[model samples]
Target: MEIIQIVGLGLLTTVLVLIIKEQKPMFAFLLTAFTGITIFLFLIGKISSVIQVLEDLALKANINMIFLKTILKIIGIAYIAEFGAQIVRDAGQESIASKIELSGKILIMVMAIPIVSVIIETVVKLLPA
Candidate 1:
């Protein structure tokens, strides 16, 4: 039922955007952005529940809360960046979209440095002195 609703909304938006694109491209772009936001908002509750479960599991596993929060922030940045890039592309700004994606990649990589360093240090510790 959820998939059906999402698909139906997608189809309807496609039709509306197609029809309005030529006459009022700005409006069509706005519609696309609104649709994206609406979909994300619809999923927010589910996302929150999933995040809560992950946090609980991490706590049970004795993982550091800071690391979990950092990972979550990185994921959020990725999703938001991709969403923004896609919206920009849809509005015929491929160059800007690519830049957005590149920025996202850089940010994600930067955030991952701590985890990567920890892994490297762990491996080094395991090596024979």
Candidate 2:
């Protein structure tokens, strides 16, 4: 049902954009950006519920909160970067979109360093000296 609503909205926006694009490109772009943001906003509640479930599972498994929080932040960065890149791409700025994606990748890598190092150290400890 939600998907149907989303699809309907998307279809409506597409038609409107096509009609308005010739006369007002700027408005068309703004409408597109607004629709994208609206969809993202609609999903925020679902995202929060999923994150809550993840937190509960992590607690039950006795996982490190720091690691969990870091992983979540990385996921957030990925989603935000992709969203931003798509918006920029819609604005016809492919180069900027690529840079945004690259920045997201670098940030994810940086955020993961501590977890990666811990895994490596654990493996080394388990091996014969």
Candidate 3:
């Protein structure tokens, strides 16, 4: 049902954008951006519920909350960056969209540093001295 709703909205927006693009390209871009944001907002509840389930599983498995939180932040950044890049690309700014994607990858690597360090340390500890 949710997918149907999302697809329907997307199809409708596409038609409207096509119609307005020739007359007012800027307005068409704005409409596309707004619709994308609206869909993202509509799915926030579902996202939160999935996050809650992840948190519950992490707790049950005795995983570190900090690591879980960091991973979640990384995922959030990836999705947001991709979304932003798509919008920019839709507006005909391929260069800017690529920069956005690059920024996201850099941020993800930065955020992953601590986890990587922890794993390396654990591996070192397991090796013979």
Evaluate all candidate structures by whole-model CA lDDT and list the values in order. 0.94, 0.98, 0.99
Question: How well does each candidate superpose onto the true structure, as a TM-score?
Answer: 0.96, 0.98, 0.98
Better of 1 and 2 by lDDT: 2
Model 1 per-residue lDDT tens digits across residues 6-107: 788889999999999999999999998999898889889989999999999999999999889989989999999999999999989999999999999999
- What are the RMSD figures for all models against the true structure? 0.9, 0.6, 0.6
Ranking by lDDT: 3, 2, 1
Compare candidates 1 and 3 on lDDT and give the better one: 3
The TM-score of predicted model 2 comes to: 0.98
State in Å the error of residue 50, model 2: 0.3
lDDT of 1: 0.94
Cα lDDT of model 3 by residue, 15-70, tens digit: 99999999999999999999999999999999999999999999999999999999
Best by lDDT: 3
